[model samples]
Target: MFKPLIKKIAIRIKFLRSLSVNHWRYLFRNLNLKELNIILVSLGLAATAGLFLSVYDYWALRTPAPAEGGSYAEGLVGEPRYLNPVLASANEVDRDLTTLIFSGLVKHDESGRIIPDLAERYEIKGNGKTYEFTLRSGLSWPDKTPFTPDDVIFTINLIKDPKFQSPLRNSWQGVKVEKIDNRRLAMKLPVEYEPFLENAAVGILPQHLWANIQPQNFLLTQLNLKPVGLGQYQLAKITKNASGSVRSMEFSPNPRYHEKANIARLTLRFYDNQESVLGAYKRREIDGFSLSSPLEKEELARSRSVKFYDIKLPRYFAVFFNQTASESLKETEVRRALAHAVDRASIIEEILKGEGEIQNGPFSFNLLDIGDPETIYEFNVEKARNILEKDDWKIGDDGLRQKKIKGKNIKLEFVLTTTDWPELTRVAASVQKNWEDIGVKVNLDIVPVNAVQTQTIRPRQYEALLFGEVLGLNPDPFSFWHSTQRKDPGLNLALYNNKKADGLLESARQESNLPTRIKEYGQFQEILMKEIPAVFLYSPNYTYAVSKKVKGVAVTAINTPSQRFENINKWHIATKRVKK
Candidate 1:
């Protein structure tokens, strides 16, 4: 019987190699499932081997499976749309892989202070626009090319090129890049200079290998999917689908990383959607990932065999209404009325399933951290109606809102573009219902994650948009809610043009002294809170479920913008085996 079981296992192992890529995907995907099913079948066979199969109660079978590596096997959000850090946005999956593949001049600390990474020290000119940085010696790319100032210069040039559509243009556009020496690079900024010292947070790319790729179309370049990395991971194998298209991302530890690679290898398996993503996790098909569902959180938290984490992070998914739309939302009274109508409290409690806290003010969360939640506007249906009435938006015979605009009843309708974040989708539906309660029309359009960024939000093409954005801790209202950001390379999602908001934001940006900067940003927050340009929503917490064996788990306030694995090098598995 033992020999027969061994033969069966051997045949399965042999069959695994001959399988096509899709079957290979299925096997690796169900590795935990296959392994567990075999174990359970073996246990049942043993029970059958014993003659007394009394009542055959499945008590042990119903018991929870041991929380092991399988819980980690799911919800990784699939392979990144963009692998190159220079082209990537704030994608968690891409950023995690990029953290392995690239290193920046300065890295942020647990306290949000800028610390040295590739650069040992930096010097700023008196005006604060020109920054000169000196690199640390003895750094090498995975391909053994020497790290130099030329790479920095080339990267800066690449970002400045309009054809690259480089995502960093928003942050890097104001700067002129130049190599001071083989070991140094200097930059000239466009203005009084805020976010410069911090912009070192941008990952520096390896120009030696990527330079040959045409900047006009770098994102689609064959090299992007398998580029040489300067960070902690080196590409191991380029796996293709059955059709021979690229799919899985596999990398081994980079021998050239300045610090030791904590994990031996990193593999990100592809899944078409979140359902499959979660399924893989439930079956323990992958490791080291993020969670989206409330049930997943509850189950993972209770699993004593695995380490679970729920760190309160400072990321918010807010709705930005185009105030300039048809003069319906332009009325301060009507816009504020729409803002006041939505019951964020009930929406969060019901739709979000108690996953977040309502934002205190427009600029609080991780950026400013000052606002009275209670004093902030709450849902008051009567007040919302009164405000709308003052603006001549009256209740028609149909009980829906109508305006005698150009002698016609006009019902307000707007489109909202969003990524496929389900919580936001549900919240959007709820908000639409709430807005309908106030007699406004809302059309929700769920677009691809990158499509919303590339087409709608970045270009300011929608009447309204729903998305999550993290304001850096130090506060740069200039980049986000400011009027100047309406220009090209700005993050003014609302396309909001306000002289007062612009003045306040610029003042906040120009203030170099910490106290002065904080005071100005506080004032900016106050104005934004009053303006109600973008509906203040909840800041959702980031959840991490780790294995108990992993040690040194910690989190910072800005955990949502960056990965918990950003500092993963300092972490170690306590139960890790000593290799021979």
Candidate 2:
């Protein structure tokens, strides 16, 4: 059967091969119009199918990729003062510019996980007390100077130096740095600190350029505006107003960067306030900007071209009770009464416009997984009144709770001090009303933003203070709750003194085990809930707005506002198709 079929196929192929061009034309001419039309239609359909298949194959093989071109401009509410990382800690604009213009040994990724940026790799030794970093080989600064261990040492020393007056001085106080080789260095901490890696993430300064600058003249140096670093971008030009204030800055891609930025240029335009920034964005003067207040989101949502990113930050706001200033706050019952009186949900809904999460403890919800909803102080006016009444505090004719001790009558009235930020003012008003409903008279002391720290916070002048504190990604409660931090220059605004909580904070910082640290923080939070040192209100979500023209912004969480640029090098404003 196989031989017969093979013979038939050979005969048919030979017959077709024997047909000349004239024979084929004669056969086509002999066909009727219907057959000719059918043949033409079949050929046309086959050609169309072939074309479709070819197009589909090409489409399937190609992929959209970020192209190495385009520019991005962002609007910021303030001007950049110090592009140096050591001094940039206090200003958001400075920090934002520093993050893009400098490289660090390590950096937090989009997920808020620490990853190597300048260092090729790092080793945690000496039971977490020592961190050894090995810089990437062949890395050079914008000035063509080789990046070495000396730069890391110089940067760390500048942070530790008293003359520099770096806000980060406190964190580097007990740390010691040693240069091992050309590209390697080791940092020794006074104790085993699990968050030591976070400190390593500070941007390293180029030693060769900065070593000769006097500490007194460091801030006045032109290098602050024109810096040299191994980062994704470098300062190209700066436009200043008539008063010499920086109006806008332009940055180009750094040729010496470890990872090249897809976007060729980055521009930052400064404004006097958030309103001005938003107006600039609306006028198409900027491609992106960060929201100062969540309430602004509603107004920007009307634009179809704008995309919003609700980024979670490790920050929370609270009302800290200063028992030293107000004798009545010394009573735990009184503190608890005030805590239970304020409706946190209402505050989040009304003031934050539901852009916040109810925070029950000192830690942010995104930073710690130790939150227990049952332990939260739910708002209850009756409970607040009952607690005051049971504590021998009776409502007087003036509707203020009064308590008599040693023949002296004390009224349940205290001043609540807060910065005059619009959000805080609304929160303070809500809290004041909540307390007043429970026969507790609250006097709101709205202080200006510039004067709050010097006149109110540092002096510990307020009886109760409404404030926000950024815990950062590491979320260490030591500075905010430790007994040693109750004084000026310390963050313990509550002036809370608790030996047990202090020990737990210390232990938590030293504890390397995640589970153990969580347990320690949980216990510390329990103590805080019982003691009622502060009433935690909410953690507001940072709203970052970007034009839809840009892409590849994958940030979900940030330790600071600057960290929103964690994956910025990957962002692109132009795209191209490439074969897979």
Candidate 3:
């Protein structure tokens, strides 16, 4: 029956073709010359219309769409020692790989908002002290083990364990995790902490695989070199050089991954230094690389094929005044005068090469309105001098200002301590020159990096400390500002203490609602501006260089170098043409 139907259709097609040919022949043979010419022109016009329609139809069918199945080679300036999430916080190379290999209960988006990852949804309860998280249904690790409350409780408990020595120990201290059921968990904090959600973004570890490992041997475990994760990518291959250093690592998409990653494979190549990294990129040995050091104008000009992206980190550099250490720095007028004397704009432009944003206060993510642009101090030597003079500070014959307090002559001189990095030294020198121009003597005491942290900052020995604080996303200024943190090991380098500011900081930390947090933070900034304890300098941009071959990279905020890969699942190396 089907054969007869096919034969009938073929016969109809042949008959139609024959009729069309005979009609065309009859018209050509019998028509007059003028009529034939008219028919020829009409046929030509119809053919031209048909040609245009064909081209338009072809073009319409081909529209660009994201295509899969490509690999990427990224270069970094360090080797990975620990791929485990519990220990890779300070290692950029390790963090880069771990970010793609592990999934946290919560993860930061490109905009730095903390969103749920392994958890289906979460809620804050009971005065913001208790956090309830519900895990997504049917979640599994790369090895097909069911992801449950046990994994979440195990990770938190391990972090809180003193024997584990995990880098996340500090954040989880005083926080207790309770397993409600297979898919539910609750975390209770000693106090209301707003950054708790951000802390939850720490990658979760597989309980079954790690439970057998002892705490002392956790770092030495081979799993650090070959990790099992529940992220978009899983460890596939690792190659090492003769020197016993990891040369490269290749990652493939996880078969049990919840979502699809456009990138099929990602390979990372480790190098010794920035020069070697840049050389590899120039030679096309690698596709892209990320650097904390911003590129110089000449260096940026050299990379013609690479696309550069600038992401402003949440860190800022400032000269924190120790009021308790120096008698002169204790005066509010003197601190304000010194703050106004330094040219922050010039420091960023000349020393930072326009790669930093001038910071008005502690908040870097625009959590507060900068408050009255007129209040922002500008570089004015005369204004600074007049401020000192109005406060009865007299200029001495030595070109230094002096003030008489309690029957003692104290010169307007203080030692400024900072690290020995060339960039920081240049900034310190620039700031010193500006302060000295205003009759304020500045003694530059540059020390080694470790000495600056251990000797000067930790002990609070310097009169003024020049330092940078990396405030992670969902920044909580409590550790850096609250009066309780003014002692040794506390980040309140300025020794700042104010009842109103303290209350603001404490309340801000407890507020879980974003708008309320922003409001409270704005009030805290206002207090900082009024107090003028620390002179805020500039915020540096995290620069990344990538090959133009990759696309769909949208990095707006980066809390760490690893956060740059937050959108790796959306990045594609190839494309296809499909209908719009």
| Best model number under TM-score | 2
Q: Whose lDDT is greatest here?
A: 2
Model 3 worst lDDT window (10 residues): 365-374
Give one digit per residue, the lDDT tens place, for model 1 in 106-184. Answer: 7766555567878889988857778888988888776678999888887778877888887777677667888888899
Give candidate 2's error at residue 350 in angstroms: 1.6
Ranking according to lDDT, highest score first: 2, 3, 1
**Which parts of model 3 are misplaced by more than 4 Å?**
1-59, 291-298, 324-327, 367-375, 391-398, 402-411, 420-422, 447-456, 459-461, 487-489, 512-516
Query: Candidates 1 and 3: which is better by lDDT?
Result: 3
**TM-score of structure candidate 2:** 0.90
Model 1 scores a TM of: 0.79
**Candidate 3 per-residue C-alpha lDDT over 415-513 given as tens digits, one digit per residue, 9 for 90 to 100:** 999988667888899989988888888999999864676688878989988888887666778889989889865678888899898998888777777
